[model samples]
Structures are given as structure tokens and as C-alpha cells.
Target: MSERKHIKVTYSTLASPDPLLHEYFDESVVEAKAGFGKTFPMYINGEERTASQTFEKRSPVDLDLVMGYFQKGTAEDVNDAVATAKAAFLAWSGRPWQERVAIMRKAADLISERLFHMGAVMSLEIGKNRLEALGDVEETADLIRYNCDAIEQNDNFSRPLLSESDKHHNRSVLKPYGVWAVISPFNFPGALAGGPAGAALVAGNCVVLKPATDTPYTAWLLTECFRDAGVPAGVFNFVTGGGRSVGQTLVDHPDVAGVTFTGSYDVGMHILRTFAQGRYPRPVIAEMGGKNPTIISKKADIDKAAMGVMRSAFGLQGQKCSACSRVYVHNDVKDEFMTKLVDLTSQINVGDPTVKDNWMGPVANMGAYEDYKEFVADLHANGDVVFGGKILEELGNGYFVAPTIVDNLPLDHRLWKQEMFLPIVTVTGYEDMDKAMKMANDVEYGLTAGFFSEDDDEVQWWLDNIEAGVLYVNRSSGATTGAWPGYQSFGGWKGSGSTGKAAGSFYYVQQYMKEQSQTIVG
Candidate 1:
């Protein structure tokens, strides 16, 4: 592919991609499939290590396709990884900030160079379609580059402070914590795993990345980019195993100075509380899931409202933390919006995500597949299943389900408040804008929200009243989804995120460090 023809793909800007992108991705997918079912090892102290036992990872797109075999790491492995990181922290952190930034930038460029293969592995491993998978990889590279840029622009977060006299020099310097554990979820494995790991590393902290068991292969590919970029030994490591053994051990390790986790609310809370119960509190940057919502006003464009809501609600099968799960359309245009949404939902082609034509693939695993079924059953029992509610058994043995929309659900229903995290959405009609805003902010999560209003007053009202960290108005690409690095700061509020700061923003990289006041008296 020519460099000139390369489209800089992002979450929101994936329309009309050049045909060469598909040609290269298709070639990479075939090459990736040729080397399936290989056993992969964990990385510790810049070397590959293996456990006595291993686990099989199969694609959600097809259970018959064994993606790879990954080591089932143990508590001992976590201890080893943490100790290695701690041993390497001083040297890594002591290096000049410019050197660290250069290494991270090279790593980001390496990720971009290997984008096709990485995107292919992600799609087959986690069932994301071509564009979404490629976008995730591209975002990973951009996220790393963004953090590096933030550090450089801030001058390594070292600033001169007011001095009492000329003889006395005073300055404020931000320094790295010791060891950081990055726990990433399966959805968007490349971006979530590599993004945090990159930030922590660029901030001078050694990283111990523990990816979700379902997508270790994708994480492994990411680790190679860092290693190939000449990151020092023991500065970056990767471990894979069950959460009970490997994950808990990493979090509980006393040598660990901090953590960055992205997953469910219960697990994030557990990590936060666990990190606090130590001798002293440590930093835990956690982003839990969100039950995001989108509101449509009577004055809104019906086409934009329907398209945005459908894309956000069903993208990635609603597995994203920012997926729009709830909708409150004005009673005047509720029927019209639903008609368009259902028609758009019906046209979505669900099959093998690796195929070029398929728009969506499958849920990450059997647990999510079962959860989707239970959620659909409950929606059918309590609400009107207007769009779809069937399991796509004809689409091979993969865990494929139709995009579902339910209307007329009671406002008091628990599902309306709960985070389903599936390709299912609940819609309700509201007569008053104030009541709709109240319903939107009633949920505990404040991660992301969308509003459709052509009126300037209503737009300003929505912006002022919406409680989410990320908000969108009149977007046709996606309602609550499509946050790109440097374009939108992706984080949450309330039960959604532990920290008030968002990723890909100016303030994110500094979270990995602590400020120290420096003084020299003559």
C-alpha cells in the first residue's frame, strides 16, 4: 500500500476507506490464520517464560477456530513479574525523560507499521469487524503517541517554582511510581491494553500487563512491538491466566506501586478496595463499565437521531463501556425514530467479522453469549421487542445474536438502570425535557451520553445538564461511541471511573507520577 493512500483511520472517521486498506487486511488475515493454535509464552524480565500448564483460546467468531494456546500463569508468575519490574524501575525511571519519550514513540510507530497483522489478530480473537478492529489498533498507536506528546509538551512535568532568594533554588518535579499493573478487558484489547501500558511506561513506570484470558494473543502481539522497540529488560512484561490466580496476585503484590484497570464495576471496585487495604493507599486508575444513554428531542433531525442511536447501541454488539443502552425520545417523534432505528438495525449483516462484508461478529465469550440471551428474555417478558430478539443459529456455531430494541419498558424496571453490556437497548417516550434529563442522570454511571436537538437552547440545556464525561450532540457517526485519541478525552464519572481525569487528554500521563518539591540551599 502506498503511504499516500493510507487513510488515518479513527473511530468516527471510517467512512469510504480506500480499497487498498482492505486488500492489505485481507492478506494479513490469511497470513495470520496460517499460524493458528501455536503455544505462546508470558514475557518476564524481557524474556519469554512458560508455565507448566496452558489453556486453549478459541475465536468467538467460530469455536472451531483455535486462535492460540496461552500459558495459564500462576501466583508465582505474578510474583516473578512484579519483582522483575521493581528491580528494573530505578534504572528505567532514572533515564532522561527525552530518552523514554523516544522509545515510546518508536514503539507507537512499530504498532502502526504492524497494524494490519495486529488488526487481523484482534478481529479473529475477539470478533470485532474489520473497521472496528483496525480502528482499535490505530487508536492504540495514537494513544501512545499522544501521551508521549503530552510529556514532551509539559517538559517532563518539571517546572520552576518561586524561590525565596537567589541562593535558594526551588522546583517542582513529577516522578514515577515503582511498578504499575495494567489489567485490560477483552473488548478493544489492543487500545485498552497498549494505551495504559504505554502511558505508564512513558511516565517512567515499569508495566506488568495482564490481559483478559480471551484475548492474550492480541496482547502478545502488542508486547512484541514494545520489546522490538528496544525497551530495556524487565521494563515491560506480559502475563496471562485466570483472574482468581494470576490477576488477584498481581493486584495484591506489595511491590506494585499502582494499577490501571478497565473492566466491570465490581472488579474495578474490588481492585480499588484491595489496593487501599495495603499498609498505605496506592493509586488505582480504574474505568468501569457504563450504561450510557441518548436523548432525542422533538425538534431533532429524525435521520441523524436514528442513525446515531443505532450505531452506538449495537456497535461491537454493545460490548463497549460507552455503548448507548438507553434512549429517551420525545413522545412526538418517538414512533418515527423507532421506525428508522428498527429499519437500520434490520439491515446489519451479522456473520464472521473477519469477512469484509460483515458489519458485526459475535460476543467475546460464552459467558457474554449467555448473558445476552438472559437479557433478551427479560426484555421480551417486560417490554415490547420491536426490532430483533432471536439467536442467529444459522450463522455457524459462533455466538451471534440480532441487534435488539425494546420499547414501552416501564421506567421503574431494573433493566433500565442496569448495565446489560450486550446488543440490546431499552427505549422510552418522555413528554417533558426536564423529566427526560432526570431519567438520563438517574443511573449511577456517568461515562458517556448523546443528545439530538436542532434547537440551540435545547442543545445548550443538554450540554449543561448531561452528567457524562463524554458528550455528543447531532453526531451521525455514533451517539456515545467513537472517542478518538486527542480528539475526545475518554473517561467517566460517578461509578464509571475512579479518577476524574480522562485518557487521551492533557492531564492523563501525569496520573502515573507523583509530584515532589525540590529545594537546594546555598
Candidate 2:
């Protein structure tokens, strides 16, 4: 192995990665492929426990490829995991905040150390391209570190208040909220799971994580990193199984203190309502899916606008919650922007993502592939497909689809406001900028929005009126995508998220803990 350069690999930083990253990743892929079809156990109370049944995880790139087998955890398993976490909470939370931060920092370091292997596993398990896979793993590590930094800088969230008398002492402190359940989505198994888990654990709360059935291997690797970093036994547990049995069990568990979930809007809403229905209202930090939008002003640079929209709309096959699914461009430059976007979309290579030349990979599973076909058919009936709308049957047996672009879709169409979570974008021309902003903000989701404009006045106007939580202006890297840990705080508003607080921001860590006012007489 050669000495690797210290280059930060975030979504925005993927453009120029160190050459050694590719070499190391390719080597790790070969090593990972040699260990396929192995069965993995669930981590409960620091023990590797297996269930009576197991489920096979096949790679989306090739359905015949059995990546691994994971335990088919049941409601009983969720009960046991929650019990273990609850029992571990006292001793874990009693630890000094500094000590907890130290352990979490070490875990973050371990994640970075094993980045290559983990990245390779994620790419194979989730069908993400090499760069995107690497970015997810790297972001997980950074997200954990950012939380640690937040704790330290805030002095463990302990603040001294003015005293009425010299002998009277008054101060406020934030304390952990017992056991936290983390339900992560398939698209970002590592970051969505490990990031919240790290925050909860670092805040002196124990965590029980339930990963999406589609990508448990990545979550398993993440669990190993925390365990190896000495995150005490039972402090963090991993359970894999169906959402109804395992996920609902974790959510409904009375002993569970809080939850951090990332998935579809409907499911997130269900979790929020269910958690509230418990004995008392417990905290539920949920980031639901988004129907994100991008607006291109007449004053915008056409090339930059097109590039930004193209990357955000098609990256990860547009499975991201922050994907730019709807575009509202000024009628003056709509034709030019459409042409450039179509050309860029046409050039994308769809196939096995592990291959260096392939820029886009298959959808995560059969459901998404089927959904893509249905969406394309609807577009053909109601709108004009300017670029692509076909499934690439030539691309092996995997679920691959072309990056699609639709034009002239009616603003009143349901697709304009729905979260497709696929690589299909709709373009509509707008004559008025205010109306474009109105159309962009009309959706139930307010996750992310992008705008391209050269005029300073237009930029200020966008900053003032955009309803989304994460906003980008004239950025070619990604219009609505590419949010990093410290660079941009990623969260949503309205139906897109239950809590207005964004992850990776200054206020995120405190959400894992409840504040207490402490006072003593001297």
C-alpha cells in the first residue's frame, strides 16, 4: 500500500479524489467478492446472535450475486435489543461527557481507517457508484466527528447562569434521553444509521439501529467499527428484519426513549404518530423523502444550471431525498437549458457501477425498477420525454434504467408534487420568477431547492423566498445534492422532516438529549 494523501471525500469533494482511493477501493472489491454468501449475525448485548431463519441480500448490480445473508430478526429480537440498550443506558450515560466524546472520536477514526473495504461493500450492496459509495462512508465518519466537536465546544451543553446571591449556584445541563432507535433507509445505510447512532451514543444515550432490508451489509460493517472502537457492550445494537416486525417493535417499545428515522414520508409520519401515541410524547427525529426542485432564472448561466440539475437529478439514480426531481426554468432560456441537460443525461453510462467507466448503476431493487417503468409510461401519455424514458435491458440482468428527462409536464400533474425517488426529472417553463418560486414552494416537501442566477439581486431574492431547508445557488457540483457534515447542515421543512433542525448543524446534537436546569445552594 502507498502513502495516501489526506483529501476530504464529501459529496462536493468527489470531483478530485486522490488516485490512491481508486486503487485501494478496487483492491478491496476483489477481497470483498471472495467472501460472498457468508451469513452475518445480529449484535445484541455484545453477543453475535443468529435467528432461526436468515434472509439473503443480493446485489442490485447482479441479482444472481448473493452479497451476504443476514439474520431475520423478529419482534422478540427487537424486544431483547431494546432491553439491552435500556439496561446499558445508565452506566453509559453516567460516563463523563469527555470520555464519551473520546470513544466516539475513536470510532470515527476506525470508520476512516476501514473506508476502502466499507466503501466497496456499500457499492456492491446498494449499487452506488464508487465515488458515491466512498462519499457516504466518509460522510458518516465526518458526521460523527462533527457531533463530537459540537459537544466539546458547547462544554457538554452546560451553561452557567447569573446567580441571585454569591452562595447560590445555577446552571443548565443537557442529559441523554435513554435508549434511541435509529431506523435508516436503504439509499444511505451507513451515514443515516451511524450518524444518528453516533450522536445518540456521544450524548450519553444508547442506540438500537434497524437498517433497511435492502442494505444490511453496509450497516453491519458500520456496527463493527463502533464495536471495535470500544463502544461498550449493549450501548449500540444492530437488528435486521422486516419493518413491520422489527422496526415497529423498536418504535413501539415503551422503554425506548427516542428515535431517529430516515425513509419515505408515509413511513416517517407513521413512526412520528406512533411514537407520540406512547405513554408520553417522546422525541422523534425523522427526515422524510422529498420532491425537491430547482429553478433556473433567465439571468442564470445555462451551462452551470444544466450541469447542476443533471448531477442532482440523476445521481444515485435519483433515489436521494434531496434529488432535484422538478425544474422550473425561465421560458427565455428553457430551450437552451433543456438541450444541455439532455446531452449530459444522454452521455451517462448505465451498468454495473463497480466498473470504472460506468457512471450510473441500477436502481436499488425491483420495486424501484418497476416504479421507473410505470413513471415513464405515465410521462409518455401526459408529457414529452426529451432525453430518455426506456429501461436498458441490454445492461445485464440487473435493474438498470436510463437517466430520464421529461418536458411540458403540466404543473397541475401529480408527478410534479410527488416524490418518485427515481432518475426521472420533469421540466416546466415559467414566464414569471415569482410564480416559479411559488411553484417550487407549493409541494408538501421542503427538503432542498437549487437556483441558478448570475444577478446578485436574483440570488438575494432566492435566498429570501426559497422554502426548502437546504439551498444552493449557481453551483455546478450539484443543484440540491452534495450536502456535507460541517459545510452544509442537511435537514428539511414541512412534510419533508418532522423536526426543523438539520443534521450536521450546531443544533442537531442537543436534540438527542434533554436539557435540565441544575441549581445548588452553597
Candidate 3:
């Protein structure tokens, strides 16, 4: 796979993937599955160290299949890692910006070279389809590259701040925050872990990344890329364990500077509140999941909206924070839209993500499987199940479920307003466009919103009035899905995120550092 060397490419809007991707991913998947289960150690102070206890990571595709065993990192491990990062901070932070950019660019290139292998690991680890898995890896590299580009294009963000006079020259420079703890989500492990770490590291901060417990291997590979690029030891660290033991410890650690988290609202808020309690507030950048919505107007193309909505609602099993979960359609076109939606959703093939033919795959683990059952039960009790309300028992022991869609539920129902993060969506019809838009924004979570309207007036109104960080209109690929890094810097509003700034954009890297004013008077 490395010999083939997948050349890096950009994805502005959603487009069909390369045909050769299947051929490459399938062979790598076979080789990856055949290899012996790995044993990963905590990377601390530039060395790989093991803990007394370890935890198993089993494949969601098959319950008995052990993907690997990772060290169960403890508070001591977090402390050691942070101390190492803090110790190395002055040298790493003081390193020339040009050299840092060079190393990061090399890491990005290395990520692109190992795309197929990394994608294979992501497939088994996270249960994303082959195309999606490959795309995730690619996005990771692209995000790093984008940040590197931003650093170079902006002259390392060291511009003059309106020089007062020749004698008193004033300027500003972005400085590292010492040690930035990166807590990434499981849905997009490679990209989320590397994306934030890249931003932090390129901006001259040491990074201690804590990947989601379930997706350690993918993050491990991403770390390998950076390590291979010769990032100084103690500058980058990776630790794996339960959130309570490893994660909370990192959050509460004294020397640690700031945090970048991507997960549920409850946990993100907890981190924010914790960081806010001290004498001086520390920076906390978080992207919590959302109960994202879509509005289909009467003048919209029903076929286009149905196809786009199905892809967004079921892709990655609807696990993305930006995935479309609740959709409101105009009453005049409701019946026709429902028919097309059910047909499109039914056509999705669910099975092992490693398989090229499968479009949808299992939920991440047993917890998500149980959550799916509970969420579907709540939906059935509260609404009319027009399609897909059962689990697929024949699809091995994997946590597989049908792509479910229901209608006629109260727009304000807890299930409708809350973020389920499952392959289930609720639909309702509205007579007025204003009411539909209102229903879309009723939820406290405002991360992503989609609008399907041919009319320019309605599109403009939706774009102007919708309270979301990322907005889509008449998108055939996905209504609320598909936020590329350079294309769209994905972020949230209201309860969805602590930071209003989006990732994979200019402002994101700036968050990893604090600004300092420099003045010289002769």
C-alpha cells in the first residue's frame, strides 16, 4: 500500500470516490485482519512504556475478534506525560516556525503515503465504510496540510501591529500554550486526533493526545506518522485508558495548559466548567455533538432532498455530530419525499465496514448498540414508524441495525430534540416555512443545519436565519453531512460547542496559542 503511495487530493464538495480505492482498501483489510492482535503501550517522554493493567479492544464487526490490547493508563501516566511535555516546551516552542512547518508538512505527506493501511485500521476500529474510512485518513492529512499552509501563508501569524513609530515598533506573535491535551472522538479517530494535534504542534506547543478508548489503533498509526517525521521525544505523547482514569486526570492536571475535546454535550460542558473554576480561566476548545436538522420546502426537489438526507442520516450510522437527525418537510410534498426517502435508505447495505459493497456498517460498540435499542423504542412509542424499526440479527454478532425513519412525532419530543448519534431519524410535515425553520432551531444544540429549497428567497432566509455554525442548501450529496476541513471548518453554536470557531480553518490553529504583544523602543 505504501509503495502505491496514494497521492493526496482535496475534496471541496461531496464527490464519488476513486474506483481504485476499493481495490486498495480490500487487500489492505485482508492483510490487517490476518496480522496478530497488537499490544500498544503508552508513549511517554519519547519512550513506549506499558502499564500493569491493560484493556482489550474488540472489533464491532465480530464480538470475539480482538483488535488489540492497550495499556490502561492511570493518573500517574498522565502526570508523567504532562511533566515531560512541560519540560520540553521551551525548546519546542522556541523552535523556528519555518522548521516546525517543515516537520509538520512531512508528517502530512507521510500520512498520505500510508492512507490505505490507516484506512484499514479505521474500518475495523470505528465501523466506517471503506470509502468513509479512507476519506477520514485523507482528511487527517489534509487538515495538517491546511494548517501548515495557513502558518506559511500568514507568515507564521507574526505581523506588525500598526507600528507606532520607527523608534517604537509594535508587533504581535502567537505563542504556544505549553502543553495542550487533545481528547478526540471515536467517529473520526485519525482526523480528530491528528487534526487538533497538528494545530497545536504546528503552532509550537507540545501535544499529549488521548484518543477514544475504542479507536486507539487508528490514532496509533497517526502518531507513528508524526513520530517518523522526527518530532522530538517528549514533544508528542499518546496514552490509552478509560476516561475516568486517564481523561479526567489529564483535564485536572496542573501543568497541562488547555484542552481540545470532541464528544457529548454533558462531558464537554463538564470540562468547560472545570476549566472555568480556577483563579484564572484556561482555554477549552470543544465540539460537542448536535441534534442537527433539515428543512425541505415545498418548492424543493423532493428526489434530490431525499437522496441527500438518506446519505447524511445513515452514513457512519449517523454517528457524526453534524449528521442530520430531524427533518421537517412541507406538507404539500411530504408524501412524495417520504416515499423517496424510504427507498433510498432501504437500498443501503449494512455489514462489516471492511467489505467494499457495504454502504453502512455496525455501531461502534456494545454501548452504542444498546443506545440504539433504547432510542428506537422511545421513537416507536412516540411516533409512527414508517420504515426500519428492527435490528438485523443475521448480520453476525456485530452491532447492526436497520436505517430507521419515523414520522408524525411532536417536534419538541426529547428524542427529536436530543442527539441520539444513531442511524435513526425523525420526520415531520409543516404547512408554513417559518414554522419549519422554527422547529429546526428549537433544539438547544445548534451545530449543523440543512435547507432544501429551489427558491432563492427561501434559501437566503434559511442561510440568514438558521442558527448553526455550518449550513448547507440544496446539497445533493448530504443535507447536514460532509464538512470538509479546508472546505468547511466544522464547529457549533449554543450548547454544541464551547468555542464558536470551526476546525480545519485559519482561526482553529490560533486557538492552540495565545497572542502576545511585542514592543521595542530604542
Every candidate's lDDT: 0.93, 0.93, 0.88
lDDT (Cα, tens digit) per residue for candidate 1, span 299-355: 999999999999999899999999999999999999899999999998999999989
Candidate no. 3 TM-score: 0.98
lDDT of 3 at 160: 88
Query: How many pairs of residues collide in each model?
Result: 0, 0, 0
RMSD of 2: 1.0
Worst 10 residues of 1 by lDDT: 1-10
**2 versus 3: better TM-score goes to:** 2
Question: Where does model 3 exceed 4 Å of error?
Answer: 5-15
TM-score, candidate 1, is 0.99
As a TM-score, model 2 comes out at 0.99
lDDT of model 1, residue 486? 90
RMSD, one per candidate, in order: 1.2, 1.0, 1.4
List ranges where model 2 is wrong by over 4 Å. Answer: 1-7
Error of 2 at 405 (Å): 0.2
> Candidate 3, residues 148-233: lDDT per residue as tens digits?
99899988889888866789889898888899999999999988899999999999999899999989899888888999998999
